[model samples]
Target: MSKLFSITLSLLLLFQSFNLDMIDVAQLDDFLIHAQFHKQKYGDNLFVFISKHYGELKTQHDLEHREEQKDHEELPFNHQTCSHFSAAFVLSGADFTIPKTPQLADTLSNFFYQESYCHMENSDIFQPPKVA
Candidate 1:
């Protein structure tokens, strides 16, 4: 992706997350109720109705954020280090042992020299079938 696209997408998601955090369903319900109240009281048109809804929403948000700013200002916090840093490490104690295996000279160790001797009586008995 291009750098500009990446930055724009990141910023869009960030601002959208903040917007989602600030707005709530209950707050929207309150806005709707107030809009209806204003419409009924003043018999305002669509323009006035939309204006009042967003106007109240922005005003309430501003007031809430202002209070938050004031609260943050009252805190006696600075960028100074508040606590000491601590670090710990342990030495690894690993022991490896390789077992020694005896190697065979040949893979076919099971096969050995066999005697090819056969009895003459056994060979005579192994004749072909004869016709009657």
Candidate 2:
């Protein structure tokens, strides 16, 4: 009887965990919808541009963290890296054009930052960079 009870308890916990993951996924879907809207409002290839830059930022962050740990010192973080990287990517790509307006660029940057923050905050599963 004790063994049966243990098995049932384990199954219950597993099911609860699965339900929680589903809820997280649903929330992620909502974030994606907002991202899609911004992409369309600005330019079709905007998503791809932002995603590529975000990946580069994350990689840089990871490398900085490792270097800091190894050196036992904090490295100076570049505040303008995102803006500079985004500008370069936009200039390099000729297939699609991102709006040159400051407002549009700022809006796109904000969206990318927020989405990246949400993913890092809420999910344990690594989300692959999305291109649209």
Candidate 3:
């Protein structure tokens, strides 16, 4: 059961890290070709162009807007004909809490003994002779 759970979790993370739902193979190829041609398009000894208009998904994002920044969807979708994304995998699991062990007595002698009184002043509690 634990192994199955681990495998399931691993697959989930794998899909998320790769952005499986956001991928289109043909689009990726087109984006790469377009990126290669960016030098000719910009025409300015440009080592890099980090503008929001350069590289981005040309499709509208319906779900990537909930938790993520809306600017991802707000960027110009016509600048690039295909989706351009970066691969990222983040593994963070350093915050774990260790349970404390219970304190226990080493032996049965923890409590001294069950206190019992055999002697009585009137000696009528049992109404008979009592042995020490």
Q: List the candidates' TM-scores in order.
A: 0.26, 0.21, 0.26
Query: Local distance difference test, per candidate?
Result: 0.55, 0.48, 0.50
Show the lowest summed lDDT stretch of 10 residues, model 1: 71-80
> Which segments of candidate 2 are over 4 A away from where they belong?
1-20, 44-54, 57-132
Writing each residue's lDDT as its tens digit, candidate 3 over 62-117 gives 24334323433333232334568999986676766699999996776656767787
Clashes of each: 0, 0, 0
User: Tens digits of per-residue lDDT for model 2 on 1-132?
Assistant: 999999999987997655444444445554455446546764646455344234454465346456334321211121232223334334565568577855544443433333434556456466676789
The C-alpha RMSD in Å for every predicted model, in order, reads: 15.1, 39.5, 16.9
lDDT per residue (tens digit) for residues 39-115 in model 1: 68668765665643344554553464564444223222211334568999866786666998998687567778899
Q: Which ten residues in a row have the lowest lDDT in candidate 2?
A: 70-79
User: After TM-score superposition, what is the CA distance of residue 129 in candidate 1 from its true location, in Å?
Assistant: 56
| True-vs-predicted CA distance for residue 121, candidate 1, Å | 63
The true-versus-predicted C-alpha distance at residue 107 of model 1, in Å, is: 63
Cα RMSD of predicted structure 3: 16.9
